[model samples]
Target chain A: MRNSFYTAGFSEVMHEVKQDPREASYIYTTTACNSPHRGLSAAIGPALFGTVKSVRALGVQLADSTGGDPDGPSPMDLALTGIASCGVTTLLGGGSARELIFDGIEMLIEYGAPDGEPGQAVRCRLSVDGVTDEPLMNELVEQMQTYSPNMATMIRPVPISFDCLVGTDESTRRQLTVEAEPITDRRPAACRVRWVSGTQLVSYPNGRRMLRVDQPKQLTGVDWGPNPQEYLLMGLAADVADQLGRVAYRLTGERHLWEVSTSACEDMRGLLLKERDVVFLQGVTCRVVVPETLRAETGVEKILTAALAQSEVRDLVSRSNPGGVSLVLGREG
Target chain B: MELNGRTAIGFEEGRSSSAKWFDDLTRVRFAGPVSAHHRLLPRELSPETLAVHAGTYEDPVTGCVGTPVFQTSTFLLDDASYSAFADGAMRDVPIYTRYGNPSQWAVQEKLAALEGSRSAIVTSSGMSATASTIFALTNAGSHIISAYDVYGGTYNLLREDMPSTGREVSFVDPNDLAAVRAAVRPETQLLFFETLTNPLLKAPPIGALAEIAREANALLVVDNTFLTPVNMRPIAHGADIVVHSATKYLAGHSDLTAGAVVGRRKFLDRIWAQTLRFGGTLEPLSCFLLERGMKTLALRVERQNANATEIARFLATHDRVAAVHHPEVGGPHYADLARDDYRGFGGVVSFEVRGGDDAALAFMGRLKIPYVATSLGGVESLVSMPSNTSHSSLTSGQRASIGIRPGLVRFSVGIENVRDLIDDLNDALNGE
Candidate 1:
C-alpha cells in the first residue's frame, strides 16, 4: 500500500511498531519454483514471454531492452506500476479510520540517470484526489516511504534537506573522530565495541586508550561524545592525511611543514528524528598547502593514489553498501 | 498653519484645505509609522525585511514550510512531455538536473526576486556563472570591455580562455569613465565591471556605465558579489544583468560554494540553455545550504558591515598597519559614489601590513579567533593574503598594477562582536 505523510493512516502506521509474534529467523526464506519446459530463455525487449504453465496466468514478464517492445510494458514500468498499486491498496485499506477516500491516486513516476550516476533514481509526482491538509500530507509521505514494508528495502527514495550549521562542538567532535584512525590494522587492527543504553564503549586490542560514544546534546542524555557520522568521517580524513603525508614525504625525501584542509558534504534532512537512506558524504575537497617550491609538484596525484590504496577508512567511505545493520536495545552501561 | 484668504483654495470644489493633507499623503511615502498595510508593497518594506521574507514560497507537493530539494539527476517525462520539451515548448517540470531542477529553481526564484530580475540561475562556482554569461552573450569576434582590477578568475578567463574561443576582451581602468567610454568600440557587445572592485574596493558608477552601454548598444553586466543585493540591486540601476559568487555573503556560511546569474528572462533563458551544455549545474545539497544561508543574509550582512567599518577605522589609525583599503577611506569621490549607490559598505577590509608578505602571514597565524583560510563571508572571521590566494594567478607585475601589494591582507570581517574582533586583531598584530 502507498503510504503518504498526509494520509490519515501514515502517522498511525509509522509510529505503531509493535513487535509481532513472528519468527526471528536470521535466514530469510529461500526457495525456487519448478520450471523445466518454461524457462525465461528468450527475452523480447523489456517483456519476457515464457512457455505454457511457466507460472500459470502470470507467465509473461517483460525485461528492459533498447528497442524491443513497441507496445509491451518494460520491467521498470511494471515495477513502478507495482509500487503505485501497492500504495493505492494501502491507502484504500486505511481509508476508513484515516478519513481518506480511494477514488484514485494519480502518480507520474520518472526514472533515469542522465549523468550516469549510480542507481536507477525515481521521482514520483503524486497527486491525491482529496487532501486539503498539506503539512500532514508531506509528513505522511515521508513516513510512508520510511516505514512501509513494501519500501523496507527500496533504499528510501525520499529526498532530504540538510542545514550546514555545524557549531564548535560538532567541529571538535569531527576533529576527534579523524584522530581515532590510527588504531586500524596491525596490532590494534580488530577493535571491539559494546553498546550501553545511550552510550557505547569501544576498546582496542593493544592500545592503551578506551573510547566512549554518547548521544548528541539535543537528545535527552548526558551528551558525553560525538555521534556515529562524526567518528566515521573523522577516521576517514585522518587515514587519508596519514597516508598522504607518508607518500608525499617518501617521494620527496624532504619534509617541509604542510597543511591539509578538507570539507565533507552531506545531507542531514532525512534524519529529522527518523531514518531514511541518505548519502553520508556527497563529496570531499582536500586543499593541501605545501611550500612554494613543491606546491605545484606532480607528486600530489601519486600521493592521493597511494593514500586511497592504503587506507581501510577510504575503503569504507567509498563503499555504498555497509555490510549490515542490527539493533539490540536496553544494554548495561 | 496659515492659509491665503484671497485664494480659492479651501472652499472650492475638489480643492478643499482638508484635502491638502492628501498631497502630503501622495508625496510623503513611507514617512510615518509603519502598519500592516505599509508592508503589503515592496517599497514599504526595508532591505533587511526583504532579505528576511521576500522570495519565500510554499511547496505545492508537501506544503513544506521551506523549499524542497529535488535530488534526482533526471525527471520522468512521458513521450508527449519529452517531445513537447524537445520541440522548444518549455514546461515547468524539471527534465534533467543539468538542464534545470526544482532545487535550482527554488534558489533562482529567491535570487531573481532579490536582484530585481525576472529570473536567475545558480552555478557550481562564480567562475562558471561568469564564463557562462560571457559565452552565452558573446561569440567569436565579439568585443567586451571590463576593469583590469576584476576578480583574478575572471581576468584569467578573459586573458587565457576567451582567446582560444575567439572572443576579444579589453581590460581598462573602470574608475576612469572617459577611458571606459573610449574603449567601448562599435564592435563591443558587453561592458562588464565589478559593482565594487575586489581588494581595492573601487566603486564603479553603475548608472554611468548603463548610459554608456545604452549609447553603444551594449549590455552592462555587474558582479555584485561584494555589495550584495542588500546594499545595491544593480538591475534597479539599469544594468542588464547581475552576477555573484554566492559562496560569499549570499551563502553566508563558508561551508558551501555556489554562484549566480540574475537578469531578464530573455537573457537568462539563453544562459540556461548554455548552462545545460556547460554542465555547471549545482546539485541539490549545496543549493539547499545556500537557500538556508540566505535566510539570515540581511542579519549577517548588517553585522559584518558594522564590524568591518569599525575595524577599518581602527586599522587606519594603527601604527602597525601601513594602509587601509575600505570604501570609507578610498578617497572622497569613491566614498561619495559608494554612499550614493549602496546602502552599506561591504564586510571586506583590505590593508597592508607594516612589513610585507611575511608579516602578513605571521599576523594571520597569530590571530586566535579568525581562521587563516582562503574563503570569506562566513559567520567566523577569515584572513587571507590575496597575493597567495585569490590573486595568485596574476603575475607580480599584474597584481601590483591593480594595487594588490604583497603586504595586502583581505580581512573578511565576520558577525562577531566588534570589541572581541578588535582585541583579537590587537593581540595578533602587537603580540599583546
Candidate 2:
C-alpha cells in the first residue's frame, strides 16, 4: 500500500464529490484489522459541518447547526454540541475495541431556546443502524452517554469573556482603546477596555474616560480543559491532525501546511417547524485549509477525505444510530 | 387616673409639708444586690445572655469576663495527699488534661445545659463522635441498624469497616418502619440515622425510629448535623444519642471542625471511655472556637434556614429543575415527619436537573456564587453532584436504586443574601 500510494495522482484517482445539504444520508461499515490497517476508514459528507459522530463501529450521529457565529455558545447550545460529539466519539472507540459492528445508529438532541428568539430554536439529532444484540446496543448507548464530550461541557460551563483594543501602532504614543462587551457576540477576538481615574486624555466605548495608566495588558487566556466540550474538540482536532499527518506524509514526500477546524451544530428545526422532539444535524463541517499544491499532488480532492478516512468522529457520525431521550419536569406549580 | 396598686395618704399631702419632719426622718438604703438573687429571677434573661453569662465564674486573678483557653497538660495538686486522690480515694480531682480540664468542662457543661442533655462528650470531628458512639454502643459480632442513605463516610464505616471488625450493619430505609423492624436481629445493639440524610435531605421520622429502637432494646443515635438543635433537637424527639458534625452549621464560619455526642450520662460515660481509650478528644483551641461558634448558632441557623427555604422555592419553580426532593415539599409523610421532628426546614435541599447528568453538570458550572464542592452546612452556598463526587464509588445501578440520579444536585444553602442565591440559581437554570 505504501508503494502504491506514491503513484496515486489527485485527478487520476478520484474526482471531488459535491455534498447536498437537503438530503440526509449516512454510511455504515465494520472492519477488523490485525494491529495495523492501510486504508483511512470513514467519510462525513460536507452537508453536516457541525454534526457530531457518536460511537465508532456502530456509528451514531448527533445533529447540531449553530455554525456561523464566532461568539460564545448560546445557552445550552455548546453543551448540546459537546455531548453529541463526546457520546459519538466514546461509543465509536468503545464499540470498535469490543468489535461491536453496527448496521445503523442515530441520536436526537433537543433543548429549550432562549425566550423570544426568532427562527428555529436549537435542537440536535443523529441516527444509526445495522447492529445486532439489544444488550450491546443499550450498552453502547449508555457508554456514549456516559462519555459524551459535549455532554460533559454542557454540564460544566466555563466563564469566558474577551476584551478588544482598537488602535494603530506608533513609536512614541499608540492610542489604545478598550471595549468591555458581552461574551455572546460571535467574534473571533475581542478586547477589554477600562478607564483610569484622574485622566481625561482617552475615553472607552462604555463612556468611562480612559487615561494613561500603565503599559497595555494582554487578555488572559481561558482555562478550557475543565470543560468537557472544549476538551473533546481538542481531542478530536489533535487525533485528526495526527492521523492526517501520517497519511499525508505517506502520500506526499514532505509535511505541508495543514489546518483542521471542526464545528458542531444542533438542529433547531423543531422550534421553527413548531414540532415536538424533531431534530437532526444541520451538518458536521471541517474546513481543512491545506495547501492547494498538496491537494493537487496527493489526489486529495477534499481536505476532509483523509480526515474522514482516519477520524473516529467521522466513523461515528456516518452511522446515524437511534437513541432515547428522557425528560423530567419540576413538581412545584 | 389612679395607680390601682399604690397606697396614698389623702388630705395630709398639702398639710404635712414640714421642714422639721423631713429633717428628723432618717433614710435607710439596702445593701448592693446579691448574685444569688439574680439567679432566682424566673426566665427574665434571654438565651443569648445566658449562653455567655449563665454558669460563668469570673477569673479569680484577672477578673476576665471571657473564659480563658486553658492549654496546660496537667494541673497542680493542692495538697500533699493529692497522690491519694490519684489513687482513687478522692472523687473530684483533675490530675491531667487528658482525663478532663476545667475549660473543657465549662464548654461541655454549657452545651449540656443548652441542649438539655444529661451529659455531653466533645470529640475531634463529627466522624469521631459517631464512631465513638457506635463503638461504645456495639461490640464484636453485634448487629447495627442504620439508614440506607447516610453520610458516605459513615456508610462506609458501617458497611465495610464495621464488618471487618466482626460487626454487621443492616441498612434500612428509616422511612419504612416495617423494613427497619424486619432488619433488626437478636444481636442488634444500636440504630443510627441522620436527622436529615446528607445530600439526600430526607428527614427521617426520629420519634418513630426512636420508638422502634426503644422497643427493640437498642440505642438510637441521630446525627443532627443538618438540623441543628436550634431547628431540630433529636433528643427531644426521643433519640437516645445526638451527634453533630460541628463543621456544618455549628461552626457557621467554616473555620473549625469539631463533634459532640449529647446523651444520658450512662451512654456518654461509655463514649468517654472509648474516647479515652482511642484518644479522639477535641483540642482545647477547637473546643474554644466551637464554644464561640455556639454563641451565634441560633442566629446563623435562623438565617440559613430561611435562605434555604427560599432557594428551594426558587428551584421548585425552575423549568430546568425536574424535581425538588426537599422533605418540606415531598410526600405527606415527610412533611408530617419534618413538622414533628424539626422546628424549621433545614438548609440543605437536593434537586434533579432536567437533562440528567449533562444538565446537572452544566448548571453546576454556570453557578457564579455558590461553589461547586462537597460537604455542606457552611456560611457560603455549595453545590455537588453525588453521583460523580461523593458517592462515585458506588456502582451506577446501586446509585440509581438509592434514588441518586445522574442529574441530582445537593445544595447547602449558606448565609448569603437569599436574593443573591436565588438570582444566581435563576441565571444558571435559565441559561442566561
Candidate 3:
C-alpha cells in the first residue's frame, strides 16, 4: 500500500527516464508572484514586489498597516509554505534511494509570531509513510534540511538585490486583450481572429484580404501565410528578440526595436504523422542585429546568448512532446 | 556532475520563456465576464448576463483573461505529491486530461449556474453524459422509468442498451402523469425525460414527476438540451440531476459536441467517477467551444424560442399541415402539461404533412432554406423527417405508437427572419 505512490504517477516517467537521462529532470518555474505584499506591509504602502526572474516583484500592502485587519498569507507564511514544500520535495527526492514508497506525507510547522525581528526558533512535525528504520530516516531528514534549495536559502542567507521596473523614468506598462470569433466548423479549423491593436484575421473566403492557410509546398494550401512550422521558428526568434530588446534597452538606453529577422527549414517527412510520431523542424537558426555601437560593446554576445537562453518558447519546443498527439478529421453536420 | 544525463539547473542563469497571443490560450474566447465565479448571487443577474459571466475567472499564472486549456497527461509529481495522491489527498492539479481540465471546469461552473445546481461535470458527448449518469445511478438489475417520447439517442440507450446491461426500463407516455407514477418499481433508480420532449415538443410536468420520483424514492434527471436554462431550470422544479447536450442550444453552433450533468455535489461526483472510467470527458478545445457558445445561450435560445413560437403558430393553421406538435399549438392538453416549465415552446416543432411519407419527403425536398439533417439545435434552421431520421431504426408499428407518423417532419427553427422562414415553409407546404 505504501509503495503505490511510486506507481501512482511515475510508471511512464520511470520508463522514460531510464531511456533518456534528460527525462529524469525537468525545469519548472512559476510565472510571477506578489509574495512580499503581506498584510501589514501591503496595507499602508506598496510592498516589495517581484517577477519570476530579474524583476523584483513589489505589491502594495492592501490592508491596514497596523496589522489590524486580516488579509491573505503573509510573507513569513509564504516562506514557511515554501520551506514546507521544499522539505517535502527534498524528502521525496532524497528518499528515492532507500526503496521508500511514500503513500502520504504531512507536515506541521510552527514559528514564533513577529514583534520586530521575531524569534529564529522553528519547530517541525513530519509524518510520512514507508520509513521503518529510525536511524536511516533521521539521516534522510537531515540531508533534506541541509540540501533543500529553499531550506539552504534559510540556512545560508543569500543577498537579494532589488531591480524595480518602475524605478526607470521610461517605465511603461500595457495589458493587451484579443478576441476571436468562435470556430463554426472545427474540421477545417476556421475562426475569426482579432487583437486589441485592431489586427483582424479578416481572411475569410471571398472576403477582402481573405487568406488561405499555407502548409509545406507539397501540402495543398493557398500559400497566403507561412506554415505552422515556420511560425514556430518565428515565435522562438521573436521571443529571443524580445528578451534581447529588453536587455538592449537597459544597455544603450534605446527603446526602439528596429528589426529582428529569423529563418528556419524543416523536413516534415517524419512528422506527416501518426498519433505518437511527428517531427516538424530539423534545424533552426536565429540572427540578431543591432546598432554598430551596441554591437561592439563588451560582452554583447554573452548578453544576447543569455537573452536567447531566457526564451522559454525555444526551450519548450526544443524538447520532445511526452504526451504525443492525436488528430481527428470529420465532416460538417 | 549530471544526476542522469540532463543539464543541471545551475544553467538556469539562461534558459527558455513562455508567452501567449491574445485569446489563443486554448481555442476559448475570453469573452466571459471577468469574475463571474466570485459573485455571491449569479442568479440575481439575468440569464443573458449569467450565461456570459458565470464560472469565468482570470488565470493567476499567465494572467490569461480567459481559462486556458491545461493539455497534458500525467502531471509529473515528486514523492510527497505521489504519496499524497496515492494515499488519497488529491489536490487541484490535474493528473490527466481524461479525468478533467481547467477548460472543462470553467464550462462546468457555468452549467451549474445555468442549471441552478451545486455541481456539474462535462462529458465528451450527450450520450456519454446519459450513459455515465444512468450507469452511475443504477447498478446491475436496477430499474429505470422513462417517458415514451425522448430523443432517439436516449431511447436507444434506455429501451435497448440498458436491457443488455441488466437494467429493466419502462417507457410511458410523457404526458400521462398517472402512468409515469404507476410504472415505478421498488428498485427504480431514476425518472428520465427531456425538459421538452424531442420532435413532439411537449413539456412533461417536471414538478409532478419530481413528486413521483420522491414517492418512489428515485432520482429525477431532466435532459435540458432543448430548453436551455435560458428557459426554465429543472432543478428548481425538484430535479435531482439536469443533463444537457451542450452540443445543441448551449453550444448554439454545431461546431462542438459536449455534454453536462449538473446537480447535487454528491450525485455529480458519482457521475464524474463514471465519466473518468468511461473516459468520456470533454477535451479542452471542445470545452472552449462550449464555453464560447454558452456565452450566447440565453440570447440564442431567446431568438430561437421567439422564432419557433411564430413558426409553430403558422404551421398549425396551414392547410397542407394536418397537425402541428408544439407545446402551445399541439393541443390544450399539451399546453396544460407544458405550463409547469414552458418559458417558450422551444425551437423544435413536429408536424404531419397532408399526404403522408411522400408528402413529407416532398416538403423536405422543396425546402429551400432549412438543411435536411438528422440533428437539431443549430444557428441555421434544420428539417428532418422522423420516419427517416430519429425513428428510422424503429418499425412502423413502434414509430406510430410513439406518435411518429409517416408524414411527421421535425423543424428546428433558426434565428432567421420570421417572414422568410414562414414564406419558405409555405412554398414547401403548397408545392406538390
Chain A TM-score of candidate 3 vs. true chain A: 0.34
Say which prediction, candidate 2 or candidate 3, comes out ahead on lDDT. Answer: 3
lDDT (tens digit, per residue) of candidate 2 on B6-52:
11111112111121211111111111111111111122344455455
Stretches off by above 4 angstroms in model 3 are A1-333, B1-41, B73-84, B87-91, B330-332, B338-340
TM-score of chain A of 2: 0.30
Residue B369 shift from truth in candidate 1, angstroms = 0.9
Q: Highest TM-score among the candidates is held by which one?
A: 3
Instruction: Please give the lDDT score at residue A1 for candidate 3.
Output: 19
> What is residue A278's positional error in candidate 3, in angstroms?
63
List of chain A TM-scores, every candidate: 0.38, 0.30, 0.34
lDDT tens per residue, model 1, A1-333: 112112211221122211211111001100111112221111101100010000000112221122223333332333233333333333332332243333334443333424322442433444554455566555455444543322322233221111111122233222111212322232112223322332222322122233334322222112243333333333433344445445666787654333333333332222221333432233333333333344546565565456546544344333322111121112212
Rank order by TM-score, top first? 3, 1, 2
Instruction: Judging by DockQ against the true structure, name the best candidate.
Output: 3
Ranking by DockQ: 3, 1, 2
The per-model DockQ list reads: 0.01, 0.00, 0.01
Q: Report the lDDT tens digits of candidate 1 across residue range B311-396.
A: 99999988889989888766643644747668787899999988899998999989998998977778889999999988988889
Clashes of each: 23, 75, 19
